[model samples]
Target: MTPDLAPQGALDRAWQRVADREAARLRDLFAAHPAPILPARAALARILAALILLGSAALTLLGLWLLLRALGLGGVSGGARVTSGLGAAPLLLFTWVARPRVPRVEGTPLPEAQAPQLHALVRRVGEAVGVTRPVHMVLSPDANAFMGLHGPRRTPVLGLGLALWYGLRPQERVALIAHELAHLKNGDPTRGGVVQAALNVLHQTVSVLWPDPVMEARAGLPEKLGNLILKGAALLPLGLIHLLLGLVGADQQAAEYRADLLAAQVAGSEAKAGLLDRLHMAHLLDSALHKQRHQPQRPDAFAEFRHMLDTLPPAQWAQVREEHARLRVRLDGSHPPTADRLRVVQAWPSEPLLTLSPEDAARLDAELQPFVAALEAAATEEYLYRTSG
Candidate 1:
């Protein structure tokens, strides 16, 4: 990838121009496909309302039981208590079942001296931006680079991609690096990383507890007539799963937007515009189409559990092992719909884009302010949202 041989001040000015261009681009994007901010806000409000309602209901229930005992109208009912206890069992089971396991990705550091070209570029960029050089560079097939704070000091790791390395021009590569560094400057990664980790664990737990049969059995009880009213509490964990996922999706999108703005500012408007178009085009041609091509070989978690069970019996184990072998094929699934991504990029006002009238530009800018504000709000909430159980 080509590094900007220009002086640091020149790079900064170029970056600022790109940032302004990106702000305009985002404005156009918001105008073209207005995000349903009101609906999302209403949904968020509803969640808070539901939480309050749940607390009130719980308090009311407790009050009713206490009043009954004081009036001598009720006392211990063994059968009812037993049924309630049975219903509460699943809720207790879920506490443990829905917890996430941290994935053990071994930290692999690459030798820096081997890639003098990259080191020189990063060093220059870091010096210009007033940030530390990346602690390590990793080569992975995935189209991603993240900066995060880990351990006591919150060090940075600049993970690179083999695909990006081969595909992007040197200038574009510099743009990518700038984008990641922006994330560090904005403190998005360091602030939001812990929440992401927590949600991962929560998702894993919910996946275990919300199997079809268990969910079906959970729905059989009526709330008004029985002590086993909470039989359907499994739905709580399921709802949490969706909430966690939505938060992650929204945060990721905002993070990308911020990074785009920052990178464009760092690398210059021309480079940013070129890189955006190329990145979208590359994704459309390569990764976007191939996203869902590989699936895990096992049919489901059931198959994994059954295989484990069968291992206890030599006779059954062989059949189970064979089934596992046959199922080892991966299912390819597409990531988020490409149509949405295409729409977003097309809406961006890059260099070659059609010129807008002064009035049209003003209109688009006015429309974008709220979305930009919403993005900021989402960014603010991300840290708290991620860490909450």
Candidate 2:
């Protein structure tokens, strides 16, 4: 009897050791370290604005000088001075003042009475890791949800799309939110958004300088000049630079797996296991929606090949649908291919899931009450896939 009791005690201690080790690893992974140093987005924006100002100023002066030269003032100013110096400054000012501002929409807040359930979920998970409740949550039709800075101090915005929720079970949905919160805690969303915004501005500037019209002039002085500037700017290697950003972005995506691990540890393994399946299902649903909205080209191979990969053959539409079904991952506009994300999540280690402490669970239940009510009241809107120009 003494020997039997000794073996049982040893087994219990061994299991406890394993659990401790796993928890320690998770804690380190989720620890809120200072954000990784990257180019400051606002600083970069200011720098870009300054460069534009200087360039426009120089161009204006050059145009002025050109105008003077045209009137027999400076060195051989050949060709008509079609551009006006005064006009150039005003044009620059206009561009500075007015550009299409990316519409900033706030996440819809669940009613105060309803905030308990969702809030509790976030609170339990957040308090467990020592972070604040998320600022707000949004529901969109697209199979997408992103965490990002909503305001000063980089508040977290959780866009939990309907497609994502529809595809996932309750447990999986909780895991997804947990994963997003982890991103907020890790500070990746704000950092990534900054990098993304900078890249976007740079790409926009390049496009403005020498668009396709210059290329279409079919070989002349203006064409040559435009080509020269375009070629030089091409040195920026937008594709390669974006690839590097994608890698950093992928690192953040991998961070999703780490977050899932945390969720499983704090919430339970059932939530974690369902993640991959739910993600794949959501991807499929989104792809189907996309196809329905965009009429696929006829099945002619030539037509399909000639068009962008996105424009599949109407005949081969069935095939395309089949391929997408087999793929089992969402094709995100920005993130890595769906298949790849699924693979990463699938590879994550499996361990016994842990539930939040009783107090935390109760709090989570309370906080999520409002969201649950909203979810119940919300009608299942049909997915209408449309791209706005």
Candidate 3:
């Protein structure tokens, strides 16, 4: 006998109701603006902020140099001189703050020779998006796909999420790739990196000035007061840096909206929208799976994901959507709400230029099978370790 899917049916109805209610507004917004345009003020603010940071660092170093020279002149008592030298400790903090650190990416590289068809697909997508192909492609365990610059040379690397790939349709996968490639075409990675570096400096400076209370608890009252004074002094620059980061983040969000439009152009609105929906559902299910005390052993991760999707009740899906709808975008967030993204894409006129045949999808999956198997094993082991701990 067929199992009851009344809950699932109800959830589908609920989703339709939500989609329908928001459809007109989405369409109108798209009609007014077919493509996202970066706000000029935000762009200017980002550039100005970068310049200010550079100037501030230079001024700080000059001040430290003058202070060291004055200390070397030694007009005061030895004890006073030692205290003056100690006063320069905050100057040393800038070195920690301004030090440039490369972003660490986790995953195993997939050689082009091992996946010729996949590489070809990426090349086609890159061409359509007017961006150079990534120098390397890596398979990640997370349910996400992104492109980034790595190392001193800032070489572009594409990261394909195994779980995301397994859960999405072939065309949807193409749309995901197109979206990431759009980031490269738009030069978001480089711009975002600069903003991120500035923010990191600000954050580290704040941490140094206002260390954990627990760590400083045993200090004398005078020492505590001095730390508090330092924290108060650091707040102004921190606030300014945060504001600047917000402006940069707005541009980043605009870039994301633009990428969605580009993805729709490459893979069609339906495919892009479908991919978003599946991703939302997958995230919900993945969270639940993560919380389970005893995970089911599955050799094929893709098949396991398929089974999870097939068996998930509609009521649970509806709950996930409802909760998702309640999420708000923060001022410093790089991406807009997924609902907004979905609405914008849905309003876009359908024009799919890429389609993969079932056989082609199967071939791609076959190539990824070994990698997926290894990823799943690692994920399982990690989960076991976490649960046991």
Candidate 4:
């Protein structure tokens, strides 16, 4: 007869079983949900469309010049020359569209030496997810974690939001890191970079070419005619681009689900579910508190958030949970609904892992204390400036 394992040992074993099952389930999901090919095809279509537009504009300009020369009206240099220049303006507009710079997000870097424990945790998660460690870590005021490529070499940067870090349990924090690391493993950052670059170009092109009614209202007849020409060039192409982006957006949502599944494997299903549920509850509670307090100005919004979470009535909390469960998947959003994520986690076996001791929690808090004041100060300053402006 075999001796029975301890409770914690048994729990770990169960989680491992669940993880193995989830891996097989993921394979099946991939088979069932074939990758969306529409977006890639659409991107190619947009490139071709842009080339055609340029070619047509060139030919049209040449035709007008030739027409003037044929009709023996070539002696009218000023008007004919102006017409030729104006006819070629659309091509110049396309060049401007491609040149709009992508803006950088601002955050202070937290060096590994400054937060070794945090770095250790990140490293652990990255190893579990089979991805290289992030090249840099950043701290921001928002309640989220995201990874992206930075600089000329496109090194990976992992951003940790202080609010979310403070709010989550140790295991849940691991789940979050694992989720971000999974994005790197899944090649999402590189793929998204290409997709986003294309979309940015499309957006700039549309804005430049789309007629502004207010500007048109104040313009003379010649300016109005120019605006009309710009609008005519942009309208149909912009519509097609938007339609393609919608399909790409769907693919992005699918990526989020895949990331969540991978995170569940590393952090266990229970922790992932708890994290999602708490995030949803936090959103609901924060919204309710803002309404009740008339959006009270606070020196530290995270502190205010903690107070609200602690003070929320049990009855109201239950109601919020109910609302969270019933929430529908929002197609317009990048991520799937919280309820759906929770449902996926619920199907997996679960076990608690990496519970933080008081000493551990205190150590983590101590490491973050120095940065907290600065982050809070920045947040306060931004809030005041925005409200006043």
Stretches of model 2 off by over 4 angstroms after superposition = 1-91, 94-114, 189-194, 206-250, 283-389
Error of 1 at 149 (Å): 5.5
Candidate 2, run of 10 with poorest lDDT: 327-336
As for TM-score, the candidate ahead, 1 or 4, is 4
Better of 3 and 4 by lDDT: 3
Best by TM-score: 3
Candidate 1 lDDT over 13-58, as tens digits, reads 6754553343334334543643413114324534543553454345
lDDT by residue (144-201, candidate 4, tens digit) is 7788766655678888877677767777887888888888887542244545555556
Q: Model 3 segments beyond 4 Å from truth?
A: 1-31, 36-38, 63-90, 189-194, 210-234, 284-297, 300-302, 381-389
Give lDDT: candidate 2, residue 244: 38
TM-score of candidate 4 to 2 decimals: 0.68
Rank the models by TM-score, top first.
3, 4, 2, 1
Quote the lDDT for 243 in model 1: 53
Q: Model 2 clash tally?
A: 22
TM-scores, each model vs. reference: 0.44, 0.50, 0.77, 0.68
Alpha-carbon error at 37 in model 3, in Å? 4.5
Tens digit of lDDT per residue, candidate 3, span 1-389? 01113325776657444434433343345546976344465666567657756965775775576467548664676776566566556565665454546665568889898998999898888887777756578997766788877777777788997878877787898899899888888766234455656665666666666757876787789988887898897897688665775566556666777788888899888889888777767653354345332465555555667567657899987777676655544445566667777888887767888877778989998988878767776665665576676
Would you give me the overall lDDT of model 2? 0.47
Q: Pick the candidate with the highest lDDT.
A: 3
Error of 3 at 66 (Å): 4.5
- Candidate 1, residue 194: Cα displacement in angstroms equals 6.0
